[model samples]
Target: MAVAPPTTSQNPLQLELQALKAQHPQYHVVIWATYGGSASLLPGARWIRRDTLSISTNRRNSWNFTYGTHLYDYYVIIEGKFEYHNKRMKAADYSSFVASTAGFDFGTKQSVMRPKPEFRADSWMKHLSDDLLRHGPLVLDKQLDDVLDDVKDFLEDNDREVVMVMLSFSSASAVYEAGKPWSEGYRIKYDEVPDHFNREFKKDMKKDKDLYTGKKWPRLGEVRGKVVICRGWDVDAEQDQWGLHCRLPKWEAAHGFTSNIKPSALAAHRWNELVGDFGKQDAPKSIVLAACLHHDPADEESWIPPLQTAPILQRKAEEHIRKSTKKTKHLWIYGDEMKKKTNMAIAKLNFLGSDDVDFTRPPPMTVKSAPVLLVATH
Candidate 1:
């Protein structure tokens, strides 16, 4: 008798799902963020209404839910990008949080004025491994499996382009230590988990890519309605690393935008880059952005507000449209509450249904409804 391959308690599907959920619980935030922005104004693009974005109550608990309920023809998940801190934090406190989360005992170490290898803490990877072992894999494989299967179906389909921007939680710390050697050492320590998760997630995604081998599809090639795929993360070919690179944009520098909130700027940069890259190349008819929700949990003094993040996304989308041809963008939200909150936030931006411009598409009417009907009543 042939023996089946041995399987572990946590399969690849479960592992990937755990990593994604832990990093980006609100995974479809990108779609919600970009929907009302300028990208929706592109001609020939379909208009998405607020009511249509609600997710079934049953699916709300699912981490691997399909974005927009499979309404689009093509779906693509962009890799490399992960959620970063949208607010400021003290370096020492930030370091402590990461170390504790990873199970490192930073308290035992004495404060040193200068950094040396002797002062370096243990490899954070060990703590992370232990943490995973302690928590065990979350029971989310089934939902995630369904989501990935949906993407696989899109990849096989030759009709249109569908993309999903996936954001990774690259680290427990939102800000990395810079300049000071002590902080630099801590940054390196904190990055261990993010680096490992990125490698593993990409490995799983590549398996999906392999399924497309031997199939040939025609490129859309500047037909004005070609489908596009937009990824939010930066992929470094030389280093084989996938994540955001620490850099300052000229505009932000001129405006004195601080480092903690660079993720917003990066998000905008990736949006414009997609427009330029896709406009120049032939691809699918639809674009999917795979990005993290980037909403942080409640904290001591204050919480990361979705309202603040909403404008950043709006600005990013607006900037992209100003530089490239406009296209219809889609929005999807998981629940009624989120949909309402997101709509309100987007509305306040004055980018949608504003005095200067209107983003709401005219309601579709059938032939009979369009005809001038004369009242026959006496």
Candidate 2:
């Protein structure tokens, strides 16, 4: 299921790498690239050996990159369905990193209340420091800012503005933000994130919603001079802190999308209108995005193209294209799910898989996308 990395570099694998090189002529130059996800079909999809593609969460291999080290000019930390392997290192080096495992008995001692409990009224959410909890978009402000600082030191690029694109905004696991962008991981987390917080987030949905709203990207070609911070979901689908580069398609709460507004879906629906009215419309200066993946719904509360979600995705894409201006705005999506989704929303998803890709490991094999964001215990 790991695609075997191609022992001898076969036909498709070679071709794929070559094509990526053509599109992204800057390979070794990519200083901070966090790898993960299945975007083999995307036209411009290219990944730098960008920091070891930290697979410790996917497996138990030795540490790959340096702790507290800065090698590139940019630092992009991806937080998704991954758990880093840092137990062996001194706390100082890996002190702020994270690695998480999914599916549990709830009553277990160690994990029973490790994170979710700390955030839920029935158990957690009260004691944990919002400094690192990532329960919503605002919660990420600090942590994201810190990471940005690190990137700044590395690239000699100091830009304050932060941009984020969530795939599972309204997703429950997405409560960490608000499931704005849809993902494939939250579907399996049917119960991890709490449901109560969702209502609270929905109140702010009319603003800049998360992954679950079923909207697309907003129009941002207007600002031709601002320094932008692009944010998208981690595509690895691994549960870790540095995995924030791409969006994962999973279910909710702390472990998935952290928002309540799925604005991406809306963008997807209005794609046509947006493109047509581009120069005539008033949009944001820049935009960051999280193009995550989610479950293939089969029932009501989540079924048939997952209702409004599809429309949102389309709109977001248009918004992304609109914001490509070189000024304060740029476009970034964590996972390449769109490359595949662009062709077919449904395809051979769960054929050959592993905990490397499937963190929750459900029956159908695919992870859930985004769910309504709810408080862990509220």
Question: Residues 1-378, candidate 2, lDDT per residue (tens digit)?
Answer: 001111234544345445543543322111111121111211112133333423243355634442111111111122221112333333322221112112221111011112332223322222233323232221222343353333233223212111232323222222221343334333222343344544444344334221123223322221111212222332232332221232322322222332343545433433443333223223221122222222221221221122234325434544444364522121112212123232121111111111122334223111122111110000
- Superposition error at 270 for model 2 (Å): 4.1
- TM for every model, in the order presented, reads 0.29, 0.25
What would the TM-score be for candidate 1 when compared with the true structure? 0.29
Task: Please report, as a residue range, the 10-residue window in candidate 1 with the lowest summed lDDT.
Answer: 131-140
lDDT of 1: 0.27
* Tens-digit lDDT string for candidate 1 (64-143): 22222222221112111111232333434333223222322221111111222222323332222211211111111124
Candidate 2: 10-residue stretch with minimal lDDT:
369-378
Question: 33 in model 1: Cα distance from truth in Å?
Answer: 17
User: How many pairs of residues collide in each model?
Assistant: 20, 140
What ranges in model 2 sit over 4 Å off? 1-19, 23-142, 157-277, 281-336, 340-378
What overall lDDT goes with each candidate model?
A: 0.27, 0.25
lDDT of 2 at 118: 27
